[model samples]
Target: MKSALKKKNLVVLKVKDVKRDKELYLHQREAMMALDQSIIDKENNRFAGLIVLPTGGGKTETAVRWVLKNFINQHKKVIWIAHRRELIEQAFESVEKNAITALIDKRKHFNCRIISGEHGSASTIERNDDFIIASKDSLYRGLHHLEEKWLKYHKEVFLIIDEAHRATAKTYRKIMESIDKNAKKFQVIGLTATPFRTAQYEKGLLKKVFKNDIVYQVSLRTLISRGILAQPILKTLQTYINVAEDVSEEEAQLIEKNDTIPPDIANFISKNKVRNNRIVQEYIDNKDEYGKTLIFAVSQTHAVVLNTLFHERGIRSEYVISNGTDLFGKGIISDSNKEKIKRFKENALDVLINVNILTEGTDIPDTQTVFLTRPTTSEILMTQMVGRALRGEQAGGTKNAYIVSFVDDWQNKIAWITPEKLYVGQGVWQDCENNPASFRRLLPLKQIEQFAKIADDTIDTTELEKIEFIKTVPLGFYSFSLEKTNEDGSTFNKSCEVLVYENNKTSFEKLMDKLTAYYSIPDAKGAKKLAKIFADAEDLSVISFLASFGFYSSNDSPTINLIDDVKDIVSHFEINRTAPPYIEFKEREQIDIRGIAQKVYDMELGGKKKKAYIDDVWERNSFLQAYFNHKKLYFRKAIDTELLKLEEPELYSA
Candidate 1:
């Protein structure tokens, strides 16, 4: 066990140091120099601590350079620790070049060797080994039985922790405490991109374990501006349906406490025939356009259910969850299963889905769309999630990244990140409504209620088919009256005509009558008369009300008094011209997505009629042409020339 432990230590330090030496890239010299100085300053004694860096910033290479710069002359053993063997192997490869044959032949020093996690005895008993790599599991597994002799000789041990966020946990903390107790002279260092502990973990424990402050951090915005990372574009899918009061007070409290939009919210997002069918059938329908897409859920259970739903829909998608007894042997792909992982990366599967696992360090370069089903408040998580799709390789066929999130908590997260911090389109949050696109009509609960009633009556059509037809109707409108009283007991009554149109149509003759009657009704007596009329001829009440203004939520019965209170609120509406949903801004050096896509498409198609969805270009270029007759968006060589510099930098030589 002692021999195995020593060998494991050497592999961790050496193999990783070498792999990084090769992979390490631009602007890392200063950081490496600083880390090297820190190590040299604490040469003979114990060193255990943390190095903080943002996600996408290179922390792995910093640790590698420390080993190369400090340990080359001393020939002292260095130990690297990680929870997983894949990380150990990856680190081993990074620093592999640091290994040399001259020292091995002279019997004075051997540069590095990896200790296999599967076999504990890969370590050979050798003195003056420069570096070692070992997974924490391999070390902890053999700790009790490790030979005392091996522990005594390893005086110059350096511990490097990778993905140091987990370092605050009980197991790692215990192991480090044990190491400190036994070793006379040992040093530890930790590295992680996101080190903020979750609410469950005790606070201040991380600082206690890793005593060093973060000396350098490269923010996400900086990474994008420097062309090292992809810029993220924000977009959302919203549900405009009103909530039902059929929910219990307990459920309401739970929803409120958690700040979550209820299951009704999910129902609304899924209500639109296009959005629901589009989400489910996206993989098969757009297999060519979207080679790979990722679906992120808030929890593991959600991941499983969503995965199962997709599989049932005959979409080739899989979900990976890492915990629970039921998951003992299912879906947990071994880290060493390179062939399987490689196949997924190469698009053998239409989508490779996992919650949290693929978020941080797992690199899958071809991800084109990210579907966010869960709302997140963490800025770090939002950045990491969006960063997955924004990366583009040179000449990598035009990259079009898509994000489909519900717009509720979205604005909250956006508030944390600055407008200048954004990578792509920038303007204001309210500008989204100005875009020509509008979501098709599909009121989730009402539609679901309709289908449910039809199903109960033994209907011939499937639920999805009924949903499709309802989606096509020209208008859907519901009218209901409510009597609202002030706290002072003077009561005022209101009649509301809730309208869900076939398209985004807001004008209809029948809708005008309902509005006229609503305006005419002054008191509860008139409201009662309207209510009786609605009850007597439910279908007629709807048809009559919708005939003028072509709007409808239900074709069968328009006067359905569902959620009268909510209906009352909508009826007494006031008109205010507010800003649209999403707006973005950026500087000149940054790439403009619409600008790049339009220029590329126009050049390919050679016509203006079949222009792609360039909303801003259409607005600006048409204005430019009308006023100046220059036809600026229609292919001015100067504009295209500037775009070429932004879109195809390598092809656009100075």
Candidate 2:
């Protein structure tokens, strides 16, 4: 019965449309036509330009519809390039709508095929399709080794580079150069949400690859505020992870030397800032409080590690990463695999962790929490991650979304959010570090206190004070926190932080307080009975039960798992099987019992003598055997077959 109910709930979440008004505008249509004209005009010559549309702003559809219109008229060849396999598949599926419309235009139309490594023709040189949706790697390979006739015949080609910010990359650029040099008139257009170039992007090879041309940008904030997209309630949590001095030094070296991060940073961040994966893990564990989650990791390895961690905690989660062509020319993620991702999104997978693949073009509306496991210096990266969670509104009137960032490393580099101008297209915080007076200043303590006090007044102050145990701490000048929890065995103990103006503390606090009151009502409140139970015997479960009702205005939650919850609630907090750290920490002043037992086992098992015989045949090998025995004690466990057979070997004898 329980399994059936869970499955049914999953089905509803998959099919439901969180956003009611899904429509495109005249300006959007005009922009599509303008891009088509730009493409046709560039067919006379190649032009480098970017279309900066927010996520769900119909960028892919716009490109597809333009192709349908232009292809029917001029029979111009179109090659759509996607960076990732999931993106390529998504574009192909989305273009089908346009293809269906194209069928209505005439009796029969030009062929539009998905020319990926999986479904398309072996060679992309002579494809007769009007539209060829290809993965960047696959398309790049096919273009790299093009036949003479294929290049000569393909005169009027329109190349649409999705996630165009990455077009400056060598793989895409190499392909672009080939097509441009070979074809008569090749048009190039890049699409992305965030496009900012540091020295490398601006004056470096990117400048040569994609000249200064950004044609149009319709930002997420604008669409949401204008009611075109769902208005996202931006909930920010600044989780501080505390690592030991030694670990911190080691981690810093790893990041600085390698330009990559790991998942253990979650433990470090939680130790100092909030907790493991902070509010993200909580949301995953607590189904009633949080709808769905999208965790954005810093690297592919980190994403894999996070996925493992989520599975260990018994949470159903999936990960998406960028795949490149290898020597034999194969895509890392295929079309069927891309469909699996779409299915995961379609069904309400509790959590979906991605590296950089889903940052730009993928859409998953029910993702209420955006967990940032890695911190980037780019505001573009931050904006892209935040955009993923802002897709649709929650039924519980949660308009905005939640973002938990690991800023233990890049605190100074983060750009503060400006509510005033966050939604405006192409307006981002100027580099405050480079030019002083750009970064906003922190408000006075008195102002913050007054703001909190005012926030205390707006809501049910009594009820809020009742749950005052759930306290919030400001991360810095522009960030504040809100703590929340639910009665369904899930606890949100960490701070709910946000990025806003320092002086706007009062406004932010009021918003937080109102949110706290809204969610504080427990789902199943048998408070009277629980109170009686607590009074009778001071039961910890009673207090824990009450704590479950604990709520704050913050948008994130940490899903409570068996390991963490058992440790928190049990009278004796200890691991049953005793991991290394646990045993060592418990017996700090006592004897090393485990070590001694291991030593004895080593001696009894003829530890290194077994291997030493292989290396030193002529020696009076006692000395070598003793050294081997000592070394082997640390790694190998000792076993006695005869003793086990006599004592309790029924299962072991097999």
Candidate 3:
């Protein structure tokens, strides 16, 4: 047995970490920079904020670098909090290993103590082991292991929460409140991909936890198209009418606590031998393509059943579920389950099924396919589930992941988990409605698969002369601006935004509705229900991003001319009364052929505000890009020409 001092704490740190910090991907670097800048903006004052990186976006590494910058060697106490054992373990191991080896700090003393339960380390707080890893459950059980005076030893404290969406849990709140009411905590940093922002989640919890500070977000679509994550191809496998209708009212209302599924839904989903067998056959149908598969089921019994079905079909399979024999009832993840995951990672098992075991804080990128035997409507659950396969080739992934799901709207009314939730026309989130696109009603399953193939870049559909839109979706109206000048030659700008509750059809669109503040200027005050005003008018690039990557969590370009369509919408909704205009504040139409031309030219040298004009042109021209092309070639040229007139006034007069 290895000595306690020398024993590896599941993760071993070496010179590799020093190398790891230097080898950040561009996106990871951007995340680090964003965090760093946010901190700098705080002027070393007390600050709390979040870093939004999609899973597999190197959140760990970016966090490592950020912590090293602020938390290391300052004689400061640091606490990293996580709820799950996997996350707690992963955090301790990664931070410890990376700190010892990669940081390469002058101070050789560094230590990490894992505090979870009655029998945690009782060793004295040495200089080397100031960082503490506390499971929230451990804190709730007892505070005996930690002394009140000890909290004051460090001049400052840094609290970093992993899987931070859950940081507002009751236990977490108690711990944070205790700390906040006490000593000086320098900052709070939350790292998460799926931030719970719903009205239910937001209910004054997350804001209190993070102080509602600046938020930096990077979407999964941005990372995937940039080759950072494995591309996902989600395909729907519709369930039969009988199977869909069989989920009883009780089953529909089933809930899970600590991943223990309610008995009603567990039995309902697992006992359906027909659905079980169908899902198994679906797995086998593409077994050749899916080298390693993850089967997520509704409950433990359900997972066990799926495991048996896979084995019955001669596929190597294993399963680990919650409610293990441990006191916390989470032991399945301790030995038996961990072994299965280890074997799966080693390629010894072809398939692994579980009841929400690998949803978050577990990284297994080799999962080439995800079988969604369990459905969910929660974006948090689905996002974490799909993220299992989104890790890119750099992290032992195949660069391609498939989500195989079944859609029966009646069976699972929670819109969060259905296959149809992904049907965004042109595949953009901003354009998404709560309903499935009308175009989907026209295509068969196989044709839908073809569309997914196009999404994955596995095939090209440009050769198809015409897209057969057999059905038409009713269009929502939005106002537009044509940049028209009045008869007196003064520029007039007109816009109005209105709020409507599509609660009947779009209650889930709540999150994006927060865009109200951005577009609602005080001057445009009215009943505030104007259909003409839009919050996302200036930031419409998100439309393109959605078209390319679908919803960031779940899953287009249009046929009509974009500008023409906008004009039509604007014309329809716009109240066409030109505002009175009085100009003559500005100078001449042409550049003066006199002095100051050199001054303007000199301003374009570099780092000038006006230099952005030419730079903006170059930036837009770079958009021969396929993902969310926000190219504005003519706009850039116009800005450049105007800037040039300022630079060469003499030539302008000529």
Candidate 4:
């Protein structure tokens, strides 16, 4: 019996070994190939670029493999830098695990050292250390030590920056500059899920550092299609907690400026029994579906509260926070956090609740769902939180991951990051069965917020109460009805609807210019002459032009099909069409016009520049000018109000 059991154990060990020797995914291999080609190109000696892979796409593993094969096997020195301790440790472990077993030369010996606050210092970095996995903070503080100890001897080194979106930061830049000045031959490689920055200056800095090279890139949609990442299903549960009303102007400004929720607001949210109950109830209601869940709490107190609630309800749950004292003044250490994470990874714990600790660099691939119990304005932080559960079947995770967002009514005070925004252009709407209608179609959040502001400024509350409010006109489509004085002094309503695909303002401007010129001409002879000139010069067709504009009407189709004939064109314009009631149309039109003005006014431009831009649009864009001319009083008011808001926000607020 003992001999038979030994044989079975040997078979299991062999199977595990075989699984460990599995090849990289096709996309990962492509990334490696791109990296190899870039290294050999030799066009630029200092080749620096990014490997952009979506979360759960094994960016670190791909990079490690490439480095191991091309650099480590060649006995070259490499520095792997990450912002967080977890990432530094992860990189160290990855290199250690694959260095001996997976490398082409198994006999090659390499020393790997981790430099961080908790780990060893720069003084410990020996000359023979081939690989140094380091935290940016630790390296920045110990730069002199590094230079005196190891950097002075090693003039040739390769740098790999994990979570390289943050490479634009001051610490990262200073470190890179130091290395550049010290090293004789060096190459930089950045690995990141998000390669783009929010600010223009930051983006420029990133381009300057990476030499504007995106050597390899892959989209979230492509990864999901290739089964490299799980399909993310976003679900929002409204907490109905109105924190905006409780926030002061100072707090609001701080939140906006810092891109974080204020502690007072977070504390208030954490203490809300109703909100807590709902969050706990949600998990209890869907425990089976959620499976191994992770919840992002606003604070340590929130995590503790949620964990306690889950325990009360007989659920296996644990909360991990930074090494500190808990709410009850009990000391919480890092080891406890690691233990909880370990249990959660092993499926011993059903749920793991944390406060900011699990946002980045933590490998929790088996996480089936993430409950976003906190609100944040930072896109980077939001992306990190959402990435936790993105691992797919090919990555040894589930087929689908659920992103459950506990949404609060912020009352437009904070521009919260939504999961839908991450996959904006990634064809999330293409799969109808997987994504519901609510998740499929969405106006940009900025547009929605601007529309709300316009509604507040334009709509008469008492008047609105009398009738059911109609949905705002769809973006990129404008409709208006003009009351025109006929040639015989009789009155008639001329209705016009303009549809510009995807809000193509340039195309609309061209159409507007053509219409303005035709309408400005008084005599039929001049109109005919101008029409002929336009047709002959531009080869313009009236029907095709209108079709290109996405123009259509409920009442009548265009009678004129060619721009060469002036009579048919004029006849077509003269046809009466069914128009919305003039008063209602004007009211809606005012809101939309003001909304557009506000959007322009809110741009990150100086006052003079903004005013100049608005003037340029108003003068050249005939469609906008026509609307503004009709409602001159409202237009002037909107401009003055927006200008006041910009110049003297305090006065405007009052």
Candidate 5:
């Protein structure tokens, strides 16, 4: 009768039991696997590297998968560091969801303990734990708690950094140094859209800490071509005249001193009668072309002025600035910022305006247009700001994005966002470094002859092709004109065709090429292959397969041996999309260590808990390999006086 009852109670299980996302796109999988391989090949926990997945290209998911396969399933521990709460929350969510799905895939169970500033209480991450995702600040604050020797319980502790380009920050340095002194061996991996900030402090720090590790990298172009990102359409809205030229030399100095446009230009771009009128009218006119937009403003006041102008023009928009100043110019609560972000994401708002906050790790895939009212010189800032709109929409149809940028004609620059180099039309791009012929520079801009041609009414087709704007010439006016030399050897315009020196290129080409250059490919062939991959597949990091060959530098051209290494890695990617060597993060079921610890605590205190006891429980748990090295005294003093918090919630307050 019991047997019959058991048989009758059998629950039919479907093949796809857990909610698994579509198979990771090719590049995503490759990046995860490559980073996993690099970590595993580590002889003794000195593995530090970076993966350059374009923003919104699911770097979080890729990193999460690596942690699950490499650390979680293997019973190892992971520390994921990111800057923003949103980034941390998203990262933790990805890890929790995907890691659990992975465990479910193997019919295994492991309590994935994730502690972060967002929600993870100060619960002790016991010996047999899974992952810990923390904001950079929280990680810094909790470095002492993180220093507990948990590695003896697993193979290695892993530090996965988001926005890895900021690796040189003091917080990360402290955490790394803490781990270093604790004798807790760890593998450090960084995720970033860009690697180097400058050739000095940032470059050195990244190279030294990551061991010059470019473990997995997909060219940005490949990401777009693979449909991993949207292709951006760019238009340069020139101001017609340089604002500095319009003002006196003293006024130019004053503008520079104030770090803002002179009152005249500010009023023009801001609340002035003529320019503001033109801006609103043009924006309304182009409403059909550009979809939901994000305007990056120069200042708080500037953002407000623009917001008012937008509202007056009936654009159905909202602005969310970081500061608490109300729209009416009086103080307002800032708590609604998150609500505003939520509404914006839900498409309840047609346009979002902000000052300086929507740059790093902010992903709004549905954003169709990004307007630059503020320009910056830092390539990192510009890249981040521009990349915000490059994320493909969730529904995913046409992948065209647009960037409408304004140039400050008077200063011969843009206000807040300035691209160092760009592939402009008519077969030309300015020298990004501002040194036209500086041969000492490491990254020279690669040239593409016959990139584009300007049409002429007077000149012949062949002559039109020859007529091109001079590189690095300040914006406004200049052109190559067909001229005939007089007998006196002086040349005059015979068939002059004017070319506006507007630094505008089809967005896809320059963005793809610039990101491709980040890969440090061996030769132009690799770049071309990467470009084709970007053009054809959403999985552009097929070139990342070559990263395993130790091609971390563009100067290091691939040799015969390296080419073979590339082929070998390619074969691996083609077959084993999971972990390499037949062991895909094994299916071993884990003991309910957290459950056991929690239960013990419930028994020890009845209804109360101590942070020290909770933290030291891992040190006492005999299930771990570290149990042998356990301190009997520490176990007895479960609620060690050294522990600061009195309850379980305090353990993960970081």
Candidate 6:
């Protein structure tokens, strides 16, 4: 007995050492460290926390590695729970693969069962079954089976919930409660990309479920910058499908409040032949640019129409829906959805259209583009749809992914979740025309919308110009202009833009208020108060505030320079002294308006056409019109060529 026990201990140590030596990405390493710490510092032998990682950031692999080392190798049981079928299958596959590498001891036998409505049963959960991958519904229904076979016997058990943003649902809560009551020692960890809840009640429930404990969190920007996830380039294709007249008041209210349109409206959009044709045409036009694509359709009919259209155009495409029937009640395509997905993963199929099936937990890392043909106001659904193509080069995917959204004219009724929301607070922008090679950055959708409005001749510019641009600052952005004297005694203007993410806006406002108050009462006591305020402010808020004054540094201990005018008020306040330990500062050049204008004017349009276009945009772009109207002389040279054409059109006639 002693010899056998010693051998078991040696196996466990061997597994731990092997798993430790395995290479983990920087974020994954940090997550593992946090999980280990959570386990060690758990109260009552129980720990519940959420792991927030963006899609394709390998949250599953990280959890599997940690569980294999800590639970499976130590002869403890683990129950991996997910609501979706794909999540359950994906979890099972990940654990199965990792277990092979970590659990090499033949003497130690372990078994895994997949319990879901379609697959294994909870009643068959054996005493020796070490790992269980189950759907929440299946596990909830079979709580008695789990309690009788394993929960009552095992003193320590680990519960991992995937797509855990839905943990507040009744089914999930019931399952967790049942397990808590049955098991003596319980630890629960939830994994999700979006931790935030839109509804107030749902937020409260989520907080209660996880004790407001987020063990480890990594942002989408962090993953992209670290090459763990791809940069998402948002492209909007206008479908020209106007359904405003078809919508009822009740439908509009439902869309605005619930983030869902009426079924009849969805069906109407799905059957629009013109809109369907445009979707297929986009794919055909950009076949080479958009390599392996996944399309989210509005309905089964929409998916079938798109798939048939692609096939008619001699493109390799397939569509999958929940049911095995076409819109006409005919049988589905010869190949099953799973088989089609397999072919898509193998690169045999260029495009795979689905109706709400591939949104969550379906791992298609090689998808280079995603066609969001269906409009949604739900941020969670939008995130999941876009995340399908977010796998990075380091993770065996491309460096850049394209999120092509089919935008329709909704008469500004529904506040749809555009692809720009992903980078609203991320402080990343890519001007494709200016810097095509730089995939790490992203241009905000608001800017794109502004430009589109300027170019749209149908929209009356007179009404648009009346609206104040100041009232509509892009989300998470603050912009101001500063003029500095050059060595030659001339002044050059620089536009300063700072990004205060949505989550940090409240703190940023508070910091600004405190600074404003301190400016009114400039004294050593006020300086101390300001210093305390800065200390309490979030790091991002402090960075944004400093950035407002042209101090753009990302260093841990950056030396901040105050403007000459505000020096007296903040003379006693040590800006550098209040920076957080992890604050990074990097110098960035300010935007040169003249240079940008020159580049815009350098486009291929002829003199007369360019002049007309510039004049049209000038009248339409409210912000530019306002600024240029006030400082017409200052920026006259920037648009001199266009103005010259207007004065002497005969000299430069098309």
Give the top-scoring candidate (TM-score). Answer: 4
Model 2 residue 474 distance off true place after TM-score fit, in angstroms: 22
Cα-based TM-score, every candidate? 0.38, 0.40, 0.49, 0.52, 0.44, 0.50
In candidate 3, what are the lDDT values of residues 466-584, reduced to their tens digit?
A: 22111111122232223233464322222211111122113213222432321223223431433333345763553443333223232122122333333333332222211111111
Candidate 2 lDDT, 375-429, residue by residue in tens: 5533334556676765544222235555544334232222233321233233332
List candidate 5 segments past 4 Å from native: 1-18, 40-46, 68-75, 81-155, 162-185, 194-212, 236-270, 284-292, 296-366, 374-385, 392-397, 407-654
lDDT of 5 by residue, 270-333 (tens): 6544544555566798998887788887666777877788898888777777655321122242
Candidate 1 TM-score versus the reference: 0.38
Query: Highest lDDT among the candidates is held by which one?
Result: 4
User: For model 4, how does the per-residue alpha-carbon lDDT over 143-196 read when each residue is reduced to its tens digit?
Assistant: 887787778898888999997756766678899988888888878999987545
User: In what order do the candidates fall by TM-score, top score first?
Assistant: 4, 6, 3, 5, 2, 1
For model 4, the stretches where C-alpha displacement exceeds 4 angstroms are 1-26, 37-50, 72-219, 248-260, 311-316, 325-349, 359-364, 378-380, 426-504, 507-654
Off by over 4 Å in 1: 1-27, 41-44, 72-74, 84-132, 144-149, 181-185, 195-204, 234-654
Alpha-carbon RMSD, each predicted model: 22.6, 27.0, 21.3, 19.8, 30.8, 15.8
Each prediction's Cα lDDT score? 0.46, 0.46, 0.52, 0.63, 0.50, 0.62
Candidate 1 least-lDDT 10 residues: 574-583
- Model 6 TM-score, 2 decimals: 0.50
Each model's backbone clash number: 61, 29, 19, 0, 20, 12
Off by over 4 Å in 2: 1-22, 25-27, 36-49, 55-58, 72-75, 82-90, 96-98, 102-125, 133-144, 147-149, 163-185, 194-215, 219-221, 229-385, 392-399, 406-654
- 4 versus 6: better TM-score goes to: 4
Candidates 4 and 6: which is better by lDDT?
4
